[model samples]
Target: MSSFRVKGGLKLKGEITPQGAKNEALQILCAVLLTEEKVTINKIPNIRDVNKLIELLADMGVKVEKVGPESYTFQADEVDLNYLDTQDFLKKASALRGSVMILGPLLARFGTGRLSKPGGDKIGRRRLDTHFVGFQKLGAKFEYDSKQEIYKIDGTNLKGTYMLLDEASVTGTANILMAAVMAEGQTTIYNAACEPYLQQLCDMLNRMGAKITGVGSNLLNIEGVEKLNGTEHTLLPDMIEIGSFIGLAAMTKSEITIKNVQVEKLGIIPETFRRMGIKLEIKGDDIYIPSQEHYEIETFIDGSILTIADAIWPGFTPDLLSIVLVTATQAKGTVLVHQKMFESRLFFVDKLIDMGAQIILCDPHRATVIGLDRKYPLRGIRMTSPDIRAGVSLLIAALSAEGTSVIDNIEQIDRGYQYIDQRLNALGADIVRID
Candidate 1:
């Protein structure tokens, strides 16, 4: 395994371009299975998760070719559905949650799909009931073997109907959307996840001749079509990375510019950061954050304590709560962070607390952080990453600490972020990869 050795107290400056969204790229790659013609995807991030998905595609007899640095052409003229039942495929597929998305397209096209239990961040119990329930609504039947942890879904001629997801799961929404595109009739998805990732998926499906309305809303109306053609699409820039860079700039007192931020698609992210008094200048598609001496946390109108929480689309993203919590440590005030979606995600705050952060872990789901405000720079300490966001947040904290710090279990970070060390090195961060 590789680790990151970082020397803190460096002010990062320069312009860094955000890579393509990992979440969107994974689903988009799976969407290729819906067609036999060649589909070219531009701006695909070179991350471990994407590479794994590509390998899975190749294992199923789909031809995937790299046309450019961050581009791929996929043609699935003959997919080997039996590959889905292999041990090798199941082991790799269970490493990431996006693996579950293949169930929808596979079932719709082949009338059957077998998938092992999917895995990602072990934040909480992310049940697939919504996904299986939605699939059942589309005329699919599901059977699971407890001992093997394998799920089998079978259906014929998926007919569109109204589906009300129990919760707003991003992958669940995307899986159903991909299946409903080629169904027999109209499918109405209510309370669907409307995050930017889902929006990008919908737009790409539309470009391929799928009639989907409500791109950025909760109620999605998908008119099932008989067939879909191949088309070229570009993935959106990573908003989570944008939020991470904002935290990095604030923590290190650095001035950095992030390019191609897709300003219109950053729903409530910029505003939420602005609540921490981080000023941003949007120049066309770029975001500029000036060097900061101190950050101020916004309070309620009645002078009470302010709490920043995450909700569904149009609300703050739960994926960014870790970065936001880490950023608040360098700000000048206190803020309550409530992450409702995941249970154990807040457990990593103990590492920051060991670094001299004034954080009070209220419970498994909430934390109250009081900024040290440069009064005491966090001392470098050895830590292990628990998940993707926590891994990167620890790296950021290590980079802003007083001495050299070693972060192990960096494979978690590598799963999502593309060339993270190289990108941070380009921005003047002193980070090295060691085995």
Candidate 2:
């Protein structure tokens, strides 16, 4: 397990560009299987999870070519359906949470898809019921082999139907939308996920011949097409990473400019950071965050304690809550971080507490952070990364801390961020990868 030896208290300057959106990459890659023509994708982030999916597609007989830096052309015309039965395929598919998305395109085009229980962050229980149930509603036969921990789906004659989702799950909505695009009739999905990435996927599909209306709304109407053609798609900058950089700038008192951040697509991210007292200016498509010695958390209009919580689209993203929590450690006031989606994500607060942050773990779903106001800077200590978001959160904490900190299991961090240490180092951070 590789570790990161981070020297803390260094102020970072200059500009950093966020890589392609990881969440969108997973959906876009899976969409490549829906067409036989060449689909050229640009801005592909060179990260572990995305690369693993690409490798898996190659193993399944998809012809992949690197056209340029951060660009790829994929043709899935000769995908080997037989490979799904192989142990190698099962092992690889089960290891990536994003692999579950392939089931939709497979079942839609080829009428068969197999997958073992998918793996990802152990934040909490992320059930696959929405995907399977939506498939079943569209005339797909689903079966789960508990002994083998595998899912088998067959959708030879899928007919579109109207259904209301129990939860507005992003991946679930994307999976069902992909399948429904090839169904026999019109498919109306209510309470769907309207995230910017999902909208990008919808737009890309529309360009490829799928008729999807309600582009940025909760109600999505997909008119099934006979076949989809290949189209070019460019991924948006990762909003989560942009949010992380904003928090990093404030926590370490750095003046960093994040370039080409797609400010409009960021939703409530910039405003949320501003609510935490971070001063950032939006220059066209970029975000410029200035260094500050003190940032104060905002209170409610009624003079109540400020509570930052995650909601569906248009609300604050849950992925950045960890960064917000860590950033609040050096702010001027207290804020309650309520992680509504996952219960276990707040467990990382103990590590921050160990670093001298005044945080009270209210429960599994919430944390109350009493800002130290930078009066006493966090002292670095050795720690282990539990998941991807938590790992970055710890890294940010380490960068703002005093003295050197050793973080184990940095592979978790690498799975999401591309060359995080190298990029931060270029901006004056002292992060060394101890292999």
Candidate 3:
């Protein structure tokens, strides 16, 4: 197992450029299967999950070429469908959730798609029923082998229709949308996931000859085209990483500038942090955070304690709640961090509590953090990372702690962030990778 030896209490400085959006890459990379033309994608994060999906594509005989440091050109002109039935393919594809997205494009273009149950963080119950039902609504036949944990979708004579999703599942919506974009007739998707990644996918599809309207709204109208062409798409900066860096700066009392942030697309992320009394300046497209001695949690307008909760897009994401919880450990007041989407995500608080943070685990989905206000710095200790987000959260906590801390199972962290230690070290963070 690999671990990170992190020394806390050092103020980080300099500018950080967030890598490509991990969530967006999952959807867009799968879209490469919808077309046979060469699709150029720039700003692809060099991370484990993304690379796993890319590797899966290569295994299926998709021609992939590296054009730049963080960019690639993919041509799916020749795909070996037989490989999907291989045990090696099933084993590797089951390691990441993003692999589920392949079902849509493969079915859309080739009339068949098959894969086993995808694997991901064990944070909550993420069901694929939404994706299966959405595909079925488009005239695809679905069959699941429970014993083998495999899903087989046959897309023959698919015709577009209206679908009101049970929930606005990001991957489910993207998967169905990819299928709907190729089905005959008009498809209307209500309550669709309108995240920036979805919007970027829609934009890329439109550029490639798909008729999709409602770029940033829940209601979407897609007119299926016979075929899609190759198009170049650049991924946006990872909002989760950007939010993580902001919390890191505030927690460690660092002067740092996050460069090239798409300020307009950040949605509710910045305002949520501001609600916790962290001050940041937006200089054009970048976010600048100066050193701070202290930050206080704000109460509600009615004199009640402030509660930060995760919602769908245009709302605070659950991905950042851990960061907020850790940052609040150093703040001056208490606030509740509610993760409505997942149940087990809040379970990481015990580690923070062990490191001297006052947090109350209200339930499976909620945590109330009472700030220490830096009255006493956290005493770093050895711990293990449960998941990707929690690992980064612990890393942030370690960065702001008073002593040395060791975090095991750092592969969880590498699955998302690209070269996290090297990038943070460039900004003066003292982190060492160990085996």
> How high is the lDDT of residue 221 in model 2?
100
For each candidate in turn, the TM-score is 0.98, 0.99, 0.99
Q: Report the lDDT tens digits of candidate 3 across residue range 238-272.
A: 99999999999999999999999999999989998
What overall lDDT goes with each candidate model? 0.91, 0.96, 0.94
Per-residue alpha-carbon lDDT of model 1 for 1-435, expressed as tens digits?
Answer: 889999999999999999999989988999998888899999999888889889989989999899999989999999987777789888888887788999888876777888889988888888999899999999998899999899988877899999889999999999999888888899999999999889988998898889999889999999988778899999999889999999889899999999999999998888889999898888898999999998899899998878999999888988899999999998888999999999999999999999999999999999999988889889999999999999999999999999999999999999889899999999899999999
Q: Residue by residue across 96-182, what tens digits does model 2's lDDT show?
A: 999999988998899899999999888998899999999999999999999999899999999999999999999999999999999
lDDT of 3: 0.94
Supply candidate 3's per-residue lDDT for 298: 91
Point out the worst 10-residue segment of candidate 3 by lDDT.
310-319
Model 2 clash pairs are: none
Candidate 1: segments with Cα more than 4 A from true spot = none
RMSD to native for every prediction? Answer: 0.9, 0.6, 0.6
